[model samples]
Target: MTAPEPYAPAPQPAADDGPTSLVRAAIWVAIGALIAAALVCVVWVLIGGQNGIVGRAFLTILLLVGFAGATILDAHLAPRRPAWFALASMGVWIATLLIGAVMIWLPERYSWGGFSRFVQFLFIVLILQLVLLHVRLYLKAFQRYDTTFTRAVAIVTIILVVALAALLIVPLMLGEYLWFPDIYWRVTVAVAILAAVGTAIIPLVNVLFAPKKPRAAAPYPTPYAVAPVAPQLAAPSAPVADPASVAAPQELLPWPTYVDGATPLPMLPDGSPDWGAYYTGYPTPGAHVFGAPEPTAPQTDAAHPASSGYEGFPPPPPLPPRP
Candidate 1:
């Protein structure tokens, strides 16, 4: 069989569709509404407003409706065509503007306290909706945009953010700008205008400039590069040993066999058998002398009397002298 091919890295999946422009548009509008509300709050606090009637009549109603309506539209448009959402959003926008107009022209008791409260509530809801729907939309769009465009957008956003923070802290610099009220207001207005324009432009710029094509990543190194390799050195040779230095051959000896029913005892130095001490009656041949045989024990009366020597027996020997 042919050699198997080497393994390769798997390819990355491509994104088919990114987020739509309607979502990006929603983000712009939401930020605009928030900043507008914040400015209105500061302005209202300075200039003051009627408490009961205007607060409830315009600000509260408009804010709730706009936020609620935008959320509903987002939910509906997410799955369907973006154009439908855009058209619906336009209606909400027009309605909000009209509400603003009514608040300005319509007669009411303008209490600063009530107006401030109303503005606070309005700003809260709008900010919430903006976070949920608009910011999410911005994130989705950013995900689709290329790295270069994303970085540019990020830098611009940071600059605008610093400007907004400066505006928020503007009242602290009142003393320096107090002598030239015209210059101070002019600068504040310019900053506000720039911030609004930047808010509007960011999404549009990203949509226009972000790369449309999905970039292909660089290819991986081939198998030939990763292969196990031998070092460049002297060529390998067959291992050999000198036969003369090897161990000498050893001789095999035959074992002795034993006779049937007999055990071989180890030989004594004189080459004789060594019986144990239990057979003591046997003569130790060279050292001891033998005497006459003694009489045997009788088996019958007649034999017994003869053996005992009652009548015609030999006389007994006399005793030896004492020493």
Candidate 2:
């Protein structure tokens, strides 16, 4: 009883740690990369350089733009977690670009066979990733809104991009000459250009047309009114009586008795008048006066008074003995 209880630490409230500086810097870096790549690719396309380098650069720019748009949209509009689709797309583009740069430097440094084929395979993979990334971005942006025309545009755009990407990437990757062998690379470049434009435009459209959230309604108060009550009047009191002048009470007359045979009234089993039996033709046995003759059953021949009427009728059977 004398010993003091051990001291306990108080519970601490949860800490709300927001985004760190490093994360903000990384997002800015991604955005800068996207913008720088897009500018360089546009300049390269305008200069009209070698097909191989231009196509690769253009596709890389398209992929970068798509990734950056998705990431920015998610950061602003999405929940706390980053968009996995955008992150994956960005990672793929970075890896492909780094590998391509390494391959270009290696060929110059050493004689290497199959390097071109390897680059072609990498580009093919890049094209696939770009298609998937664009599809993801379109879905993310248009999913929240109720614009039918915009969604339809997105669907059609995605389908065309995939088909064009396939047509351009497959033949070159497989070393097959199916159609338009000379301008095949140009067609692929054109498709990449279209995809980049679409990626840029779709998000802007979403931001412009997105539905605004409705405001909350104010609460209303209900009023109650009470009615006024009327005042009640007291009842008048009776006059007092004089005790000495009060009249003597009169004796009550006796109830009248019914004389026998005075009127033809029906009687009940307890000798009370049965008014119902008197009105009805079929009277009860108690309705008859005492010492009166009992009524007999009517003969069928006497009621009919004709032998021909009784011809078709059968005779009545004898009654059973009483128990």
Candidate 3:
């Protein structure tokens, strides 16, 4: 039977926890601020008492509160939205105040000195808030994007370029206003021109040298391929010997497995008495002429002729007769 295929694990979705969400939130906030500013203006025109300092002060407070609220929300909750939020807040703050100032001036209802003083105070407050908020956001941006000296240097260069453009553009735009001195006009025009030029150059410079967005590293290189080794040839085996050609030892003497070692008694060489085996001196029957039996016992001394000295030494007294 064929084997079953192995199972694979499923992949998970990425988390939504970054700048894009904040940017979206900021856009909504800006839209809300625009609506609020329009509503306040409508309320002021319809309500008739809009001419009083009390009414203008209340409206100013209301709009400034909105700006502050949007700033705080953008800074704290949706920092990626800061640029757009800040822009919206500044636009609303500046446009509403400028329109209100012009209306007060044109009607010539409130004393010009009094209105001017109030407007100057209001502008100071607005400028302070804008500077503080922008400073905070800029610092945060710098900290997030720049750690190395090179990164900081790049950031400074971009800031200087933008500043130069502002210096040149603002003065020329306000050139015809007479109350402002020629010196002020010249400075503003110089700032606006320089800032504009710098803005143009910065983009090209950034495109050429800005750090590229980081991407995830590719998965590790594929494992190296190994070449298969050839199988080795085995040596030829030796031939088997025949079993029958080997000899077995006789049953008498003990067999010696090696030339130098002993074995069992049955395997030893035979040495029997009937085969004239040598031991001590003795004779057997001579089966020859005269057919004499070999000497059985002793022959007494012939020269002595039965001498008495041989009585006790008759020696073995003739051995006991054998059957």
Rate residue 255 of model 1 by lDDT: 17
lDDT of 3 by residue, 136-238 (tens): 5545444443446535554554565445434433332232232466786576666556545533443454555657789999855422211121111124446
For TM-score, the strongest prediction is 2
What TM-score goes with each of the models? 0.25, 0.30, 0.28
Candidate 2 TM-score to native: 0.30
Stretch of 10 with least lDDT, candidate 2: 224-233
Candidates by lDDT, descending order? 2, 1, 3
**TM-score of candidate 1 to 2 decimals:** 0.25
Among these predictions, the greatest lDDT belongs to: 2
Backbone clash total for model 1 is 7
Tens-digit lDDT string for candidate 2 (1-323): 67855786767989865444544554666666666656655665567555356445545555665566655654454235445544544454444444333333222222332466566756777677767667776778777674777667677677778777777666644442235566877777787777667656667776787777799998553221111210111144375587578665343322111232223333455544444433332247645332224433323455654233346873432111112
> What Cα-based lDDT does every candidate model obtain?
0.44, 0.52, 0.43
133 Cα displacement, candidate 3 (Å): 12
Segments in model 2 whose C-alpha atoms lie over 4 Å from true places: 1-113, 176-180, 183-186, 212-323
